[model samples]
Target chain A: MDFTGIVVVAGNYGSGKTETAINLAAACRKTGMAVNIADLDLVNPYFRTREARIPLEALGIKVILPDRQYHFADLPILSPAVADILRQQSDLTILDAGGDDVGVTVLAALASVLKDKSVRMLQVINVFRPFTNDVAGCIKIQQEIEASAKLHITGLVSNANLLDETTPEHIYRGYDLVQKVAAQTGLPVEFITAGQKVLPLLDMHRFSCPVLPIDRKLLPPWKRI
Target chain B: MAKVLMKGNEAIGEAAIRAGCKNYFAYPITPQSEVAEYLVKRLPEEGGVFLQGESEVAVGYMIFGAAGAGERVMTTSSSPGISLMSEALSYIAAAQCPAVFVNIVRGGPGLGGILPSQGDYFQATKGGGHGDYHLLVMAPDGVQEAVEMTMLAFTLAEKYRGPVMIMGDGLIGQMMEPVEFPDDLKTEPTNKDDWATNGMDTRKSKKRNLVKSLFLDPAALNDNNLALKAKYEQMKKEEVRFELYNSDTDYQVLITSYGTMSRVCRTAIDMLKEEGIEVAMLRPKTLFPFPEKAVFDAAAKDSCKAVISIEMSMGQMVEDVERCVKGQRPVEFYGECGGDIPSPEKIIDIIKGLL
Candidate 1:
């Protein structure tokens, strides 16, 4: 799994895109790549990539969030540092976009900066979600996201999960749905994400793409230490 | 009526649509926001109305106004959002409008954490707003139960001509479970020609109908209060609902719980039974017009040694439990607040201590 250049993770809400983005940044850092993750998610204030900033930074992954005072603000206060990162490409730069077309519209502001670079926008698909349950629904979301973000999705990431109750079947079912989506949208299945516990239980050969094992960094306030 | 896996929040939205509720007005709050999101697209496809109000306070009045005009309307919110809607809820209750409110409650006194909590017990059962009115509050334990309760909420709201509330915790809202909406539960909106403030020309008699909560005269206000009290009393007799688990045989301890906490108690009861500890659970499906008699009867069992109330709050429902026991036995309370769910092992420890 070579995560080079700028990778944007976008998906519908609760599709586990933030978790995938966090883990992808961590994965790139483990390979000695200089990774930086910009929290471009202004849609959801609760479960954004910035919530796991401390540990992500501990992995030597630089996290660029909104201005310090506006960390928890719902406003899309993009830091100038994100533009600097996009201008000077690092080993791996990840832009974790917010959920849905409304969230991805923030990317249109940086579209020109991202236009010249080799950008990979991965649409994280969770078939269990209400809107993206079927292939047509997934395609419709993909088209809307591309139109709003002013960039086409390069690949798909199957992130089918049901929180604590997620099983191997959920992952496989998501993989199958994304495969169909990939066929329809002409995008490759970049990878499938699962929690560290469920990864070993999954048959890796069944999926065409590699499996990215996720570390649970995003937790509710009560679950945090 | 095929079974499909769905989050509790989305399931409740579908259930509302199935129950003939075409109008939905709500502000997005954590846990319950999915209900509004799901309906925003679905209701439009179903030729229904969906609107995200500027705030929960505004959404509550939106529901009241819509319901007053003879539409089956509803709103969904969390704890703090529901607090904002309490004022409109009181107005709706006073106006005798049929509307439904779903509170996928999170922990809160004010701006509390967005996690599962049954802390809104008093707000839903007792009046949260400044009034002496009660909403028909139903608590469902799982996704399927949440759907069923939401459907029932519409009917009960119309039958009693008042607001009905379906209370669920964040766990019930976020969790995924296979649910099938029963086709038999499909319903038509209750006819409101006589009382509803629809256009006067639409009425057969061509008479004007006004829906307002304000009563200028003291006697009229008093009469309205008396009528509401009578309706509440009638609900107490006819609408009290509960379920008894493992109560067929004699038990050493009786546990009282509701909603998601009740499901946790069931798991605890199964664990305790394996260790030769006999326990019975009495779960009230309706919080308002609470199944007080059922709780009293369960606690008064000959073999029951103690009664304990388990909740996802700081002993809110325990007050009701104690009232039911009435010193017949030792009553205890165990709870966890601020989004921390009580584990089955912890519950068993509490039960053993009581024994």
Candidate 2:
């Protein structure tokens, strides 16, 4: 559960990876530690970590994205700043990659640099999403992430949510799925993310891992509070 | 069945399958590729086919080929991809083949941006291709409406025997919301054998149906244009769907908007109502068979002093709003075509300016 060193977060599409990564960086920074979050997502065109850069930067956390030339594109281009941050042996550096194996393939480009440092690669699992809805599906995603990134996943983040309609039961069920996957893979359940609405309603003692209460930053302009 | 949370793109793919459409063809594009990703895995399980063609142009013809044979077919694409499919769309419409095309519109003059935009309003409502034809365009305001409209697209396509479109923006495609697949939207394709090239033996008829869009003779082409005109007219009469928000009370500003843009307007309306400023909104669900009368009537309200077309585009829909209001009330336009959607506060400011 320690938010130290380089933390790489990968997940299936719609697995709440970007939101969790953004919140994770913000959470780590809240402890008075300098945090830098990099957006290496080359898969999704919208609703990525870069979209919330303004607010994240306003929180005194550094937000890195691809160069302005290929910013909106799903190109294989990775910013040099990301490499610089990866080499920085300081406070928390979270990398939010795109979803699925294809999404994390960009991590393989950083594999050479990653091999030099001890990185905590975490796979976010949302049991409600189509691919990671079950134990086998979660394991498959974990294996895919491991294979494509050429790195081992040290932890799992149970991020089962239904946007504005999320309830306590959803978080509970998500915690159960992450526990099952953790038991099977022997990886630690790093944390569980519940949004502002359902955070108060959840029974905190039921979850073994630490809870990260995330403010929904990546939303449509209309839905934003 | 219980409500499941789904991205609008994935919901659209599932809704088509539930509608008994077993054939789907598409080329990947931003904000809408998830529909293809979800269907490529799920379609085969239902004994349906999902094909990702080399290009949107190729995929559009694949849909045309399947629909020409009386098979329910569909394709999903973004703005640029939809533009590539326009030629085939015109061909399919001319041949009277029933097909559904989903344009999860991103910004564009050409590949403008991958964020949500209503720039395709003119492209969808008016003819994108070279023809005197119109697509039955349904604009959904959210993921749930996207699902319902996607399912209904197949039935309406068969009913009119022409292309129907689910005109969604990128936000609608990428965002997640709880949705239920209604059993009522599940429908069998109807009236196909009468005109489709479904084969003589399949329809149990000795006559072989030839599906062609060409009418070389001048008289024949005029008749074909008239027939297309008749179908569009019928759609205007029976299929015009509009939602009047806060219309029961007399409001000053009448907002004409659709899809995700209207959702923001709805929130703004509620916020404005709390401030004792009542503003009504007329949301047109069908773009081609636009709720012109509804818009005019809503604008004609005694207290209504102004009508504004609030969209995610740079005044693409404002032209239609101006025509519908007929200059009775002063018409205004407000938009942002680049990726950032106009916020409710920004919308409130615009509405306040009109007052």
Candidate 3:
């Protein structure tokens, strides 16, 4: 369960990468380690790590985001503080990347800084999404992300969810696909994510990695109902 | 005709390709962004043209230019983007250009939240843009229907040589369902050489053709308006489409709706029927023609005491229902806006009060 150094979370749109990154930051902080999150997702302004800034900051985790004036702007404005954090090499620095390779292209700017550092880039997979529904599809996305970000995916995180209707079977079904993907790609299943409600129902023995219980954040204003 | 699970937005993109529409111009907007995203990759593979315009306004004119050149073209956007394209839509209608515009409507007055809403009914059916013109608007209730109507939209647009709109809410765009775009529904693009702005030198005939909407002379303008009116009347007679449910059995109330709202009404009907309260539904597949006769005939049922218009808007379609009912039966309105969908239980409660 030791998550030290820089950890990056990457996935396709609606792949639950933001939630996974947020929960991963909280998990690292729970171990009494310094945590910092950079909202590197310039591709999607709607759902990004920046939306959970208040709570993460309250937990004593530093959150790096664009200037206040450009908070909602669609343009990519990577604050210099992100590079400073990468240089500082915090205990756990989680970079919540944007949806696809288009979003991950921003990460290439910091490739030189991250080259010598111990970096763990985990590709988050949500089986329910259109493009990443199969093993080959997941591999294609992995290759694309690696090509765009100029970084290698160290492991896989199974995050199969169906929003509000997600069930245990859905999680299990996604885990099966991720396992097949891991077998083909020779990557480890880092962990799986489930909603707090389904966490109690999941069989812990069925998974090889620890499970991360999600706290729903970054929901649309209308979906608050 | 292989069946596959597809979101409504992606299905519309696939349907346009199957309908021989290789030219697409659109700006990305919520709910309908997938259409442009899907086409960006698929169109280039099919040797078609796909361009993401700088804005919806620019995209509308791009479609106009392509359609004027006799190419099958389409564009997809949400409510606010459609509002930006209203001016071009009016000109497209006036010049009688054949193009399809898909509006996967979200809640709107300005830039509203990205959730399902049928608030664009008045805008689509009554013509949001200026001038005296109408775009043949088709409302599809589900993913499968959205695919079918998208394929049909090109045909209808070319048939009358005017703009056609496929209207659906965000629910239709985001939801996934198994669909098949039948090969039989594929249609050949209509010949546009007669009035199309294709270069005169390209054809054997050296007569130049202009596709402008302007009519400087009062007499010529009047004749143009009359011609457009005559075509609309012809459409009213030949193209009104609707679906009737439980019309055969005597019912206490008749619910009139379209698109996703009609599907909710169907569920409410089943729930009410379990309680022994009979209800009927008249779902309009075409919103412009409005299916006035079907609403009037459904309301004419002696046992049907009251008619209700259920929608996801602030009673826009209710006005049309009232117009059709003509005071023969009391008309009521129940709606939810800003992306709040009406539940079947809540609808059943409304039905109970009417009963």
Name the best candidate (by DockQ). 2
Q: Give the clash total for candidate 3.
A: 0
| Global lDDT scores for all candidate models | 0.87, 0.90, 0.87
Candidate 2 lDDT score relative to the true structure = 0.90
lDDT tens digits, residues A31-83, model 3?
88999999998875455687799999988899999988777556778888889
Misplaced by over 4 Å in model 1 are A1-7, A18-97, A103-119, A147-151, A159-176, A192-225, B1-5, B184-186, B215-223, B246-251, B270-276
Error of 2 at B94 (Å): 1.3
Model 2: CA > 4 A from native: B184-186
Top candidate by lDDT? 2
User: What DockQ, on C-alphas, does every prediction get?
Assistant: 0.15, 0.61, 0.09
The sequence of per-residue lDDT tens digits that candidate 2 reaches over residues A1-225 is 578889999988778889999998888888898999999888888788888999999999999998887877756778999988888776889999988898999998988888878789888988887778899999998898889988899999999887888889989999999999999999999999999999999888897779999898987777656
iRMSD of prediction 2: 1.4
lDDT of 2 by residue, B225-326 (tens): 999999999999999998999999889999999999999999999999999999999999999899889888899989999999999988887898889889
Docking class of 2: medium
Docking outcome class, model 3: incorrect
Interface quality of candidate 1 as DockQ: 0.15
